[model samples]
Target: MQKTSYLKELVIKNTHEKNGANNSKKETEKIQSLLNLFSIANPNSGTGTSIDGDFGPATEKAVKNFQKIKNAAQTGVVNQNLFDLLALPIKKAFEDPIQGSNLRELIVNTAKNHLQNNPFELIIHQQGNSGPWVRSYMDGKEGSDWLWCMGFVQTIIDQASSIQGKNFKSLMPLTYSCDTVGVKGIEKHLLTRYQAARSNPSVIKPGDIFLIQKSNLDWMHTGIVIDVNGDTIETIEGNTNSMGSSNGNAVANKIRNFKTSKIDFFSIAPLV
Candidate 1:
């Protein structure tokens, strides 16, 4: 597992790139890596900067191009302002204030906030599931082994619990395995199997968890239910995209039919 090092510091401290000032190799490397990351996400911004830990012409050019696209000054420099701009997505995801009247509302709101930030898995060092969002939800561990759908759900629950002074562990265990969550839900009398859920759609509610059941005892993916109407459930899930693959690249909002999809519901009534 690779430890995610995406802008580890909230604020860049004591570093200036340009005009031959305090451009330490370490800081320059961070700036270069961030430029590469930004370029990967925003194609028209610029090409990726080499992560050679040196503030070369390529890095400066990339910075200027990025500034051009963002409509900022094209000074080809990386000062505190540029660093903050680079770290904007992360700051928005982790530090934005959420509004909700209750715990379940809070959970849904948090998931939406994450979705708004457009969290996507970055391919770092040729490794999949590598990025700051994945690490934030997966306890700083990211890699091929970190299938983060469950991690994303648990993170939303944890955040809501923290804000409400409730214990999230009581509702869901801190594990990345959908199977573990399913089994624990069953043991806790919180799980409603697909058939049961379909027979009584009213049992499924927003803020509850929906697990994509693969077999009688195994689940493949999980997410937070944001809405339930008639026969379909709207969800905000991670590790999935518009195609709804169990293992995908980004966090997304999707709709799944409970009657057609083999999904189990885990009631959060115990916490509420």
Candidate 2:
């Protein structure tokens, strides 16, 4: 999906929580959902607002609390401006400033920019992998099935390459599956198998991708290779946490030992 479409859904229509205001049901539901996303950071304002498409007292309280926390006008109202304030983090995630001279530099810098933005998957309707960030990366689809590790990587690649007027699909098919990416890498002779990477660490570079190998044919989680040192690589990966589970919640920088972990490489240097 285009950036416009990705951002378009982040909006909330009609003013809510005001007497005689046009509180459309759809807009109310959207407001409730967006408010719930804050539950991870601001528990007091983000809890127990039912997403039933109703502009009730609970939703009003949540809106006012969020406004107070943000130091905005503490009027219990929902407008486009207020919605923009609420969705600012997700909005800034897509605004890439061109800052690199090459694909590798662009990729690493783009990933770092997103890491600086601190994108987090939202917990909605008690679902883990559903949120504006997830949908933006997944091209408008988000749910349990959309494990977004590869989606996040691809989004970074797309954003960076687009700045260079290049297409990442020229390197590999745009895909959400690490296994598919691994197969493509092998077909293109671009993959450095775990043992091979361990043997010749010099082959991997910054901006390459690291795939956690489950088996010869099955690769699982993936992330951007931002920095390399000896046997360790620093990565900016999504859907992972401090524990390094592939299906984690937010984008993070992680340190991995390629010599010790069953990790493979998909080199993008050929694109340079």
Candidate 3:
């Protein structure tokens, strides 16, 4: 509990210290409360600051190492995305979920590892892309199209097991995973994250994922949860599929009506 407690404290301090040398007790407390769902994905990341609120070299290096392992940008700065990743704290109650969540984190970490340790340029699959450059050249295959989101998730699992010195059901029960691919400039799909928001306004949370099905047909398509309040849930989703939407890759996803829709796969729901 102390480590859990301390880690939360550290995040608040780190976030503040990141802003400046200035300290905000309220800000620290608030951020910790919000991020308590995340845990220390890498315990061996070395000792972080117990006080002083500074995200020092050790912590930064550790995070960079963590990011490198997750295949995320290895910038040492504790940005919003990285901070969101660390939102779930590691404790007994949250530990199992953290473990499951860590599995997700593991994916990013492994991608990071591949980028650094591998001889070839490792392109971990981002949700949507315009071309097929990397998928075609795996090991000894041409035009293989051999990449899948589940594959990306599995890479993380393999790496996580390595870190924990254990074996996990990498692909596990095949039923636990499901994914879809779509383009933005394409035709009308299911309810976009935006459509769902209008219907089930309560379900949309920041950083949460949005899944869109066929034209108003309504279904889950995208995924990623970032933050949430009473009405809207902001998220980072995949498979916008070039529908000519604004914003870079992510858009304002949500539940528009009073009801919410749930995806059938294991991606959105919590795993035991």
Candidate 4:
């Protein structure tokens, strides 16, 4: 789909079903006003904060750091000018991917690049009376060009042939933590990516899964950890964009940022 169409659908999702509300419009206006606020690029360097308003963990840390810089009691709060400057997001966060030639980077790039091209853009395909092969949806619902979690995982499998392909034909998705739904012939509806990372938070590698929340209780979203710097870890995922935004590409959508604080609502680890 074109970027414009993608963005239109996203705005609808992010803004909620209701068209116009005072508070909603105001909030949207605020977010649009800034990207990064009150924090230097290297926030941990102790050089103060950057004024960007993306509101990931860095801004939160920057706020705390700024408080420490001024010795202003020790509250992790951002006020007025500082609030306007540092009113960052707690729901999402993104840090630069750690670069390397090591196994982690190799796997991350393999996964990231592959998914970036088409995460959930797989078409179910359609057949027309004119005897033409057409792109169609599974029950003629949600349309022909739509992708869900299964497609998201499959795309990665096609791309990361070396890492998981040879060992396992396909990954089994599960649901409610008690079922089993392997890719080829499985049934667990909720096996998520987050469980993979949580099991080994101390040493999360590139291919680990990062489970995020959906309407149900079990993990519903997934992502791959691309980099793991000293304190920052960058991930690429789908359906877990949290908010509907232009930055997201739906399934093969662009990865969005989130803070550990934000994902606290759901398990945000790899489901190994």
Candidate 3 lDDT by residue in tens digits, 1-272: 11122233223444443444554645433333222212122345442332223344554555565567557887765554565555422111123322325434443333333323211112122322211111211211212133223222333344444455544342232211233222221222322344445555554332223444434333434334444556544333322223422112212233331234333122321211
Clashing residue pairs in candidate 1 are none
Candidate 2, 71-126: lDDT as tens digits: 88878788899898777766676775759888899999989888876677766666
The list of candidate 1 runs beyond 4 A from truth reads 1-43, 47-56, 69-81
Question: Candidate 2 versus the native: TM-score?
Answer: 0.90
Top TM-score model: 2
Which lDDT value does model 1 have at 1? 12
In candidate 4, position 42 carries an lDDT of: 34
lDDT of 4: 0.34
- List candidate 2 segments past 4 Å from native: 1-5, 18-21, 24-26, 39-52
TM-score, every prediction: 0.85, 0.90, 0.27, 0.35
Put down candidate 4 lDDT per residue, 93-122, tens digits, no spaces: 111132335434544665555443332221
- lDDT ranking, high to low: 2, 1, 3, 4
Q: Is candidate 2 or candidate 3 better by lDDT?
A: 2
**Candidates, ranked, TM-score:** 2, 1, 4, 3
What C-alpha lDDT values do all the predictions have? 0.81, 0.83, 0.34, 0.34
